[model samples]
Target: MESKALLNENSDLVLISGMCVAEVLTMQGVFTFSSMLPFFFEEWALDSIEAGWISGIYYGAYMISVMILVSLTDWLDAKKIYLAGALVTLFSCLGFATLVDGFWSAIIFRTLGGIGLAGTYMPGLKALSDRLSGKVRARATSFYTSSFGIGSALSFLIGGLIREWLPWQSAFWISASCALVAFIIVWKLLGNYPNTTGLRSGLRSLDFRPVLKNPKAMGWIACYTTHNYELFAFRSWIVAFLAFALTGSLGNLEIQPSTIVFIGVLLGMPSSVIGNELAMRYGRKLVVVSIMVLSAGFSVAVGSSVGLAAPLIIGLVLAYGCFVTGDSAAITT
Candidate 1:
């Protein structure tokens, strides 16, 4: 019986790993679309404003979903919620792959994808949190969030390669495949872990008055918002910055923008782990605040330099990766 119990425990860990991979793939599907926007706009004859809307609409949808779904996480089976989110992502990818022919079409599909993302990201975190404890929980959350970076990096690199060899639609098709795989894995591997943390009782009573009134929760929410704004702005603009900086320095060669972004992303992979370890050894507040301040300072320096544009841009990438992701590990804790 003990041996059987150990085997079950190992299987549970494997399931968690699958959940992590699926969540990452779905995230990659949403984020990689940004890297392909330049090519997409030209192919579909979309204006810059329209392209911006395509991306912005998704985020808007994501924001709304988070506001609604995060509150419901405690009431729902997290695995089921995750599975539903993955299915939505798969449907969104299918729409993007087949139905997107114009600006409005792209916007609609992307927004759908965003809704799926909203459920996947936070709920996935909650799911992992339920299954882990203490230092292990901290480490798992770090890995889970870092998977976002990994997924984004892979999306850019793989999308670029597909665009080189085939049509841009191939990228969407690949994303669809990933989403389907995620759905399958999540369905098979993840068991229903109900939230027993009194969140349900509180939510059912509609007594968020206490949670909202809590200063510590409010403070963390504030920090998360600020951090997200900075992180999103940098992510959305980094490829453009890299392109401009490279053009100025390298004279508009046929170098891939995605490749450059991938390089910076690769450099950032260790950041979350390092940050988590630091938080464990030192303190979460100290580590998080210090990294945020460092990121702000580096952003200023990078924005000021013109002649040394490429190096400055690279420095900014490294700083953003190090600081933004460094603090990210603490947010879940």
Candidate 2:
């Protein structure tokens, strides 16, 4: 894998290490707010739909901002955009930590956080992609994609721990601090690319005509988008669903909801890495279809059995989490 070769060189090793650290550190902010959605609903007396809007607004901002921010990578060094993204994340977290009072305030702050994510995640991928080539490129991509699972897992774990031991604001503050650290890492390790300014400047006049003109590429993008939509909805609601399952007979079961989320998401990390390897050995199309089908069936089964025993429900959730994320790297690769 180019991953190993990237590490074999001392400078490339430093850069890759910095990228991973920055990725994990900043990504902790992405779900910190969502994982605390129940608290907001309770404290602010928000209805389900309103709460959904607050979460959805984040994606709205991300979708709009990423189109521009990600494209900037072609015109400039991705590292610069990443630094700006980290700064945006830091400010967004700080806003949530200290300034939120109601739905509107929360929406404003959360949307900024989403925009920050747009800057970091895909641009980081672009930076990595620019550095690798050949079969090794796909393998290295899998590793980077897998780390997103790790980032998400840690976010849930840390948010839950902070909510238990301190205040919710503490979690936000800690996430903000992590974002600052990510900015520093990128600043120190990532190279500036003044030489490449003219390379894609012409390519910067954004036109999706070429992308629309390519059926194969468009299909892959569509499939990936569908996968993301389902995956994100599952992530956002799994905790609430588990909490509801508590009212059935599982209330006495001794596990926090976020713990389940952490376990489910953490388990997904290795599943993504291993799943991509299997896709490489077998066929990518076959593996993607198999995983998507498996996850869809499991999701249906789990939904129908929400009233079942907590052990059964929790078991299904963990299993579902595995299959749900198993396709992530493979599809993206």
Candidate 3:
């Protein structure tokens, strides 16, 4: 019986691996675009504002999609929704790789990709969460969320290496491949999660009027929105800030924006696990709130320019990485 239990646990791990792969692939698509943007803008003769708009459009579309799809998760078969997301993402990548010729075209393709991501990420979480017992669910969620940080880091590293050797288009091709691999892995490895269909129908039957009455859920949403705002703002601007800050002085250095981004991501890797462990040992709310306060302080330190600006920035970045990830796993839980 003990051996059988261990085997079942191992099987669960294998199933969860598909979720990890899907997240990594999806994040690779998003992060690689950011890394490749400098080259893409140069090739297309677009200005920074235009490039920023293009990035903004993708994220905006994704945010809208998440708002719509998150509610639908109760009504939809999570596997089916997740599969649809994978297909949408796959096509979006193909569109970017083959059809996007200019700024507007790229924006369109990226927005589509974001829509696909909307279907993939949250639904994937819902599906995985439903499979575990309440006692172990938080632990499982942490593992899943940590995969995103790892994926983002790998995407930066890989995107930098790819750009070093080939054109920006090659990065899209690589992203597409990663997505395809994830699609295949999830299709084969994961079994249908039970009770999702009834849950979906019940959600569909409701008016969605009473759902917002729950102050707890609303507070959670507020926390999520605030976290996303801070995170996206930091990530979107960090590369540009590095370029400005490191210029002239770092002319002899082999610093790429992607490399710096990867370093920050690398620093973040342990944060998720550590945070989750702390949450398990202490309480999730206590751990998350404390980390958020620390992260906010680091954000301010990084934003300030004083005596030891460079070192201060690096120290703040490390701190930010550590605390930013602290809440991620808990959010899903």
Sorting all predicted structures by TM-score, with the top scorer first, yields 2, 3, 1
lDDT of each model, Cα atoms only?
0.76, 0.82, 0.76
Positional deviation of 150 in candidate 2, in angstroms?
1.0
Model 3 poorest 10 in a row by lDDT: 305-314
Better of 1 and 2 by lDDT: 2
**Steric clash pairs (candidate 3):** 74-200, 75-200
The sequence of per-residue lDDT tens digits that candidate 2 reaches over residues 121-158 is 88887787677667756766777777788888888888
lDDT of 3 by residue, 158-208 (tens): 777888897667777888888888778777766876554586475663555
Please estimate how well model 3 matches the true structure, expressed as its whole-model Cα lDDT.
0.76
Q: After best superposition, candidate 1 residue 118: deviation in angstroms?
A: 1.1
Model 2 score (lDDT): 0.82
List TM-scores for all candidates, in order: 0.90, 0.92, 0.91
Per-model C-alpha RMSD: 2.7, 2.7, 2.3
The candidate that achieves the highest lDDT relative to the unseen native structure: 2
